[model samples]
Target: MTAPRATKTRTPKIRENLPAPQTAEGLFFHYTPEEAAQWTPFSARTLRDRIAAREIEYVFNGRDNYLTGAQILSLNERYTVKPFSKTHTRVAA
Candidate 1:
């Protein structure tokens, strides 16, 4: 005799207004390609290149690239590592 067939449980997909865990709250909650562009003052292409180089950290799945609010702040702060002006340097003659 064949055993009884097990029934598969059906689950409904629920859509919420909540953001994903990887995303940051407040500003970077949810962002699209256009929104990502605004995160940085740089142009879109520049941002894409930076993302590819990993100079700025990002969460990427498939063709989607995501960044948190903290990440944006981090990128802004990265420019603080600039070198001093030549005049500020003491040259050894």
Candidate 2:
């Protein structure tokens, strides 16, 4: 007798639009790359690239990846550069 082969299967999910989860600050939800592109200057492709590169934190919900608002804000802060003061000048020895 031959052994049975294993296979993978996918199930469909159906649900109505729901609001984001509530927190001490306010409502918060994980955004897909497509949605994240709307609030960010980067495109969905760029965000996905970042996700693949592990440049930013993300949640892998079984099938898809998601980013929280906090993660986006953290990424912004991480890459932000401080401007040099005009009063500062280089001294020549």
Top model by TM-score, which number? 2
TM-score of 1: 0.49
The lDDT per prediction is 0.61, 0.69
| TM-score of every candidate relative to the true structure | 0.49, 0.59
Clashing pairs in 2: none
lDDT of 1 by residue, 1-93 (tens): 999998997543333464543454634554443455555666656776888888778768788776666666666678557776765767899
Q: Where does candidate 1 stray beyond 4 Å? A: 1-24, 27-30, 80-93
In candidate 2, stretches whose alpha carbon ends up further than 4 angstroms from where it belongs are 1-27, 86-93
User: Over the stretch 28-88, how does candidate 2's per-residue lDDT look in tens digits?
Assistant: 5777777666556678889989899998788899999887766766666776787987897
Candidate whose lDDT is highest: 2
